[model samples]
Target: MEFFSKLLFLHEVASSHGKGLDELLIYVHLLMASLFVGWLAFFVIAVFKHRRSVNPKADYVGARSHFSTYAEIGVAAIEGLLLLGFAVPLWAKSVDKFPEEKDATVIQIMGQQFAWNAHYAGPDGKWGKQDVKFASSTNPFGLDSGDAGAKDDITCLREKFLIPVGKEVICKISSMDVIHCFKLPRMRVTQDAIPGMSIPVHFKPTKVGDYTITCAQLCGNLHSTMRGEFKVVEQAEFDKWFAEKAKAGGGGGFE
Candidate 1:
């Protein structure tokens, strides 16, 4: 039952990701499925037709056919073409470009056991200053107190990420503990949050809705609880939400 639900969940996500690379991925799946069905059918037919009751004689002679050789070569050629023509190009294109800087929003994502900590760079559009030595339960980022630029930066800890739809959003991710995977299916983005290192990733959501954000990494026993949602709203609504969150003593406490 769990596997069945998981499949349905994946189907829903796959439907959303279809707006991106999932389309091609589905094509590849169809090709592989067709090939597998053909192979399985041939295997069953061969077993039945070549059985002792059917043929009564095992012949090693005349087993080698020109068609078999041609089939093998053709399968190899098709696989090679798919790898070179589809697989390589898609991977290359996905990782090749970053969002243009103009009018883009940057959000910092810090992964911890069973939760996510988010930080907005304030209006300064900079990380300000960070001090790893001073980090604790209170100062999760270990932000240097002396840094004037980091003074007004906003921070939060929660199970959700909120952003404006149709705007480019860049997420810089890092983990405080073990490695964790940050996944947003609708945006077609997933990146690993390695401890002590930041990974830059970006995406633009065309749809205005709420999408699930799940941690794909099997972090620990509590990994299942590391689920979240990203809300894509209009610009005015997002601004109002952020303003209200900040006014209510930061989003961390508000949540």
Candidate 2:
């Protein structure tokens, strides 16, 4: 059953909201298909019945039946219902119902020219102070070394972002250079990472696996190469991985 579901979706369904998003997409496409077929059938019937030999002359008043008018009104009503019923509510759930910081795994994603930097507030649960002056190739995040909160901060470069499954991940996204769009297709999550502004994007991973994070915007020449790996693992494995990164001084390099 699970295999069949995977085949139907094609992409891996890892986020808690993935099923709802997929249902919405399916419903929209089905509506479009139904409308297309109905219009095509109507066109073919009109062409056959209104041929030059059949009608002999053009009727300015056309088919006096109000059926086409009723059909157009019906289609409008269905579209209005879809917007009010599904689209609005889904948008509210994603934007208004954000998870609390204390209850969620919060991290920072800083976008640079050709790379993504993932910053995790280590065991202390506090982020280090950062400054533009301190920014460098090796220290892309510009951690203030003197700050005690920064001692255990983990910065993962080369796009190895790891999170535990079944937990809410609240990512604070920002850009160091130009604008970039942080996109995770399977999760149905996409947000703009604007320079000098931090935006929060939240999602709960429902499965343990690997996924890809790609920039959906055209930033620069290397935008195509601005891809990253996202790994969802068990809680224990995530803890161990974070611990090791912290112990190793928590500064990753670009590939």
Candidate 3:
């Protein structure tokens, strides 16, 4: 599986569930490859067998053997197994299953024209009050100044964010403007960010390192610049950073 994954040019797996996704990809591709070769062979055989010189007359009655029907059924069964036995189970186990908030890192990420905004509830485990009226270029989270919960919340604008390694991170993704796709290739995570909607997705980071975030959608003129950064670090390092960001009052803005 590793050899096939590398051959398919998949990035290094950073999330706990990434290898499963990679394996599914490899299997799907291998099935497609097999179908391609087999169909090509049949095409060549048909052309040669039905050549004009070999059979000048056209046969109106096309009678085929039951072998073809059985083959088709066999292919369909294999595909069903791939979907039911592997794909569906993986989706259920990795995607549908949600880790408890108390045991996970929950954050909100908003996508704008050419950047990302990340919001954290801080160490208090309480999210700040947010109103669309208070939302602006600098205050993407729309945090109410009068709300005590807002005081300790952390917001990082177009900057790198940190998550503890070996912990599940639940990201609530949203789009401030047009539709965008939040993609983390190494973690095998991708979720569509649509306006007026917040979608939640979770992935457990397994490797401690820096990872790149990309917008898979063609957003706008500067879509290519819609990039973000993520760092998976030790629990202590993440805690220290989180504490400092909270102490900074979670104030975020463009310079």
**Leading candidate by TM-score:** 3
Using lDDT as the measure, what is the rank order of every candidate, best first? 3, 2, 1
Which window of 10 residues has the lowest lDDT sum in candidate 1?
11-20
For residues 1-255, write the lDDT of model 3, one tens digit per residue: 878987999999999999889988988999899989988998899899999998999989864668778878988998999999999999999999999988999999999888888999987889989888888878877788778887788899889999999999999999888999999999999999998899999999999999999999999999998899989999999999999998875644422
Candidate 2 per-residue C-alpha lDDT over 1-45 given as tens digits, one digit per residue, 9 for 90 to 100: 345445456476679887777766666766788999999999999
CA-lDDT, candidates in order: 0.72, 0.83, 0.90
The residue pairs found clashing in candidate 3 are none
Q: What C-alpha RMSD separates each model from the true structure?
A: 4.3, 2.7, 1.5
Query: What are the clash counts of all predictions, listed in order?
Result: 0, 0, 0
lDDT of 1 by residue, 78-144 (tens): 7787788877886666655676765777888887887777777765566657767866655666666
Instruction: Report the C-alpha displacement of residue 177, candidate 2, in angstroms.
Output: 1.5
Stretches > 4 Å off in candidate 2: 1-10, 251-255
Q: Give the C-alpha miss distance for residue 81 in model 1, angstroms.
A: 3.0
